[model samples]
Target chain A: MKFVGCIAILAALAGTALATEIPQADRRSGYSFMGPDSRAMQDDDTSNPGMLWVLDGETLWKRKAGTAGKACGDCHSDARVSMKGVAARYPTFDKALGKPVDLEGRINLCRSNHQQAPPLAYESRELLALTAYVAQQSRGMPIEVGNDPDLAPFVAKGHELFTRRQGQLNLACANCHDDNWDRKLAGAPITQGQPTGYPLYRLEWQSLGSLQRRLRACITGIRAQAYEYGSPELVELEAYLMSRARGMKLETPAVRP
Target chain B: MARPVLIALLATAAFAACGPAGAEGLLPYTVAGDAVPDSLTGTKGDATRGRALIVERSSTCILCHSGPFPEQAFQGDLAPNLSGSGSRWSEGQLRLRLVDASHFDPATIMPSYYRIDGLTRVGNAWRDKPILSAEQIEDIVAYLVTLRD
Candidate 1:
């Protein structure tokens, strides 16, 4: 009887130990991407060259696009209040289109629906600057999206994409940003993957890029199959990332080194 | 299947037992008090206290840096080796670094542990004070200076 009791006690101890050993689930489990440093550059022109885009955007807002006699300023008198905090809620689901939309997509929507001008192509300086200028309006607002039920499916899809492993590295976005953020891979600092600040001026790229463009670059870095511009996978990924940065304030036109 | 599951659970428990207390084993970096010097070369610091600070989960210093110390196993190799930092930098330069590494490398992800000025957008909770105290800085500097190799 004592032998049996001893065996049971040892088994109980083993079970208790195992239960405690489970790895803690990370909140950022699905996607892998570098996070911005706390002291990274901001939208101000003094910190980064990309801040020039905000100035250019101000000019573009005043200048008319297309043959139509309408400028962004014609409808919205002042971008400061009118467009402020607008960038923090992007990559949102649009009921009209029945899909997710990004800052560029929204810009095109405005141009086609309101201004009747041709939508700018991806990476166009005009679009980048305008987006930068517009995103800068919400410089200090915390990111908030997917609060509605309509966005749940898209957010879920994005989460799946973030955690799923891909590419030659056989690594998922979560593998680096979530699991190894604090641990460095090369010579760079590993930070929490937060997209609260974007349309950032990176010293390496020497220009501004949309969040979608940044995502594409990351895919390239890991040697994964690059998604086409504005693909659903990229859009979903953006939606998820914006949601992850829900409470973090936006710092559009952010500078990076 | 049950036996394998049981073995896996046992292994996991063993690993968890080795991790820092209250960290849930997720935080891999050593947390140090704000006493460590930011540079490798500097005045003598308290290695004994520095060791405690580095092992603390909140400081998060060991997240990206590696050193010759064996206790910190989760260090990432992204930054230069800090084992012999004392031989590389001076005390004043080390002071400047602990205050704000971003001033030196604009893209650095390291947080500013010292300077109370120039912060624009950090969360309200972290804004009022430097992460490390002046004495802690001195102690860390002194300790790092001991790392000759």
Candidate 2:
């Protein structure tokens, strides 16, 4: 049922996040954003479309790579145990690279350094499979990222961007997630825009997607120029979102509206 | 940026209003039962044509808004029903709501149908132009004004 119906009007006015105090309710996970049916879809792994990607990722995990022709399984060996908590701990601070790296970034690093394979293009089918597969291991684990002192600067930058409003719409991420997390927009419920369910399946897409894709959609929804994939701003925003959702459970391959 | 430069940059960009003032500068634009007086430029609006535009993919009001029609499929739930909007808002208020609803609610998902400034990620083809033209806004407004029960 629509909140504002055919006869019952008086649609609730959108409020400024700046004026409103951030409610503790805003800390809710993305699961709150979904409808009952979607939650059911997520509850049953067999029905979840993201499982399709996970299955492929499982295959790729064991498949060999270039030059050395090493599969991800060769080095990591038994993702069920070895890859445990890996997704939860990203975007990790890379001491040598001197920046935080997301799950996908770490996967690429492993490919070039160990497998000697060229990096996969962002959002490629194989990349999505591998990411969904890898992230599946950490499913149900609490996100434990953005804790390192080395990641402080990047996390701070993410905060800046989250609050910064821009575009013709003049909206910031915080406007929805912080000010109206429990409020309904149009008919859709708003969540804190948490990153806990990324590399997740969205029924809207009918396919698996990376966190960057979701971020891009949000930017476009606000009518702002989306940062390019792998851009510093997007990466920093990812780190910040992960930090924001520090204690939320990772629902990789999550089903969403 | 390093601390000093970062602070300087934030100072300049943060406090600045997202969009620049129109020809009127920073004064809030007026909303009422009529078209924006000076900016309207006297283009006559036709309700007949406005009716066509509402469902047209170009104007796309129906993409998110449902009623005020018998012929078109009762569609989307993203916005309020337009069936009795004329009874709810004054003609001037309707005009202003379409021109730029954001002025009232900063976080409204409703697009500024007739605003162009402070926009990013706009396609190259439609850069610097509002979604609906001045006459089109008047046309839609004309049509909606007649919908009063």
Candidate 3:
């Protein structure tokens, strides 16, 4: 059955190759500069409030956020060294719940167990920026998740969710993004499924957001019931994305259009 | 019944005439009048130049599309394949797309590469000129037309 599926996919690819003639100029794929809209909005100043959160995070790194009075710095210091490559391993499986967990969940975990602070709200600039800064520390690191034995089930679940069709359109994330990626749908250029960069600045959103937020947008585009912030489905999906981008270098806070 | 049939035939003829060719020619960027020609000749276009333009950090075309090209390991799968776009579309049609596809489809999110009236919302100093020059467009068109298999 798997061999049949593979043959079918190959036949479809061959048919498509014969059906459409791609332009040579358009075939040169890879990274490109931000479009006009994205270039204009980029904040060159590292001192911008968003960037300033890193300084605050630096403070919060040492100062306790919870009633326990135990600071993040108390447990983990030298973020440059300790947190190095940490962000790239996130959205991993949690043995306690037997499910995947994202960076936000991990942060909240620290808030409850260590610093004892209230969990930061979703879309909060402070939370987003702090997450951004921490993730930025792991820039250039390759994604490495789901290697543990207990993580296998969650990774498999994530892969299933990545390709499963859902929503009103009966379309999976792979449909428009993977299958029809080079075709002009209404006129917008389709991009490949790359999740190595997050906390990205988008022209359409006009702000920095997490990869989960972007996934939610895709879900909405297909007219599906959006998974709530911090939902299990989103965490699983993130795990799948991280796996797909296993070897790609992290480009946190990347600008996009 | 005869009068209605005559009207329908006339309407169909008018529509066919105004289809694509009747639309305005390619618009100019910096120079006055239409700097873009109806057809290109000479060196045609350098595929090497087109390749660099597609991958340049400022163009944003590669953000959505993917191809079999060697350098694009990070290519996305969200848009249509561009491996043989030249054969599918005419040079004039390609020119229109580069200028302003929104004229054909209002809801299109693609930006107008060239607009001489003014690019107010883009940037402070940014003008109506396209990121690539007319000659560059010719080069890209020439390169695109060559994709066969």
Give the per-residue lDDT digits (tens) of candidate 2, residues A1-113. 57557224333333233445344344777887677898999889999888998999999999999788899999889999998888988888899999888888888999999
CAPRI-wise, candidate 3 is incorrect
Per-candidate TM-scores read 0.56, 0.77, 0.54
Task: Report the number of clashing residue pairs per model.
Answer: 25, 5, 36
Candidate 3: residue A119 lDDT (0-100): 89
What class would a CAPRI assessor give candidate 1's docking? Answer: incorrect
Compose the digit string of candidate 3's lDDT tens values, residues B82-135.
687777776566655655554554323345454433222222223334555556
Best by DockQ: 2
Q: Which residue pairs collide, candidate 2?
A: A168-B119, B32-B92, B32-B93, B33-B92, B34-B92
- Tens digit of per-residue lDDT, candidate 3, span A1-257: 99999778876764443233223243211134335544443344352223454555676676666788887767877777888887889887677867777877887787877777888886677667667777878877877875766766766677677665544333466655545554544335566556766777665786677888898888765445677899878887888777666666776656677
Fraction of native Cα-Cα interface contacts (under 8 Å, chains A and B) also present in model 2: 0.28
Q: Which lDDT tens digits does candidate 1 get at residues A26-100?
A: 433111333444233453357666678889989998887766768999998899989887788887779999998
Q: Model 2 off-target regions past 4 Å?
A: A1-16, A19-26, A182-186, B1-35, B38-41, B51-89, B101-111, B120-125, B147-149
Q: For each candidate, C-alpha RMSD in Å?
A: 17.3, 11.3, 14.3
Best by TM-score: 2
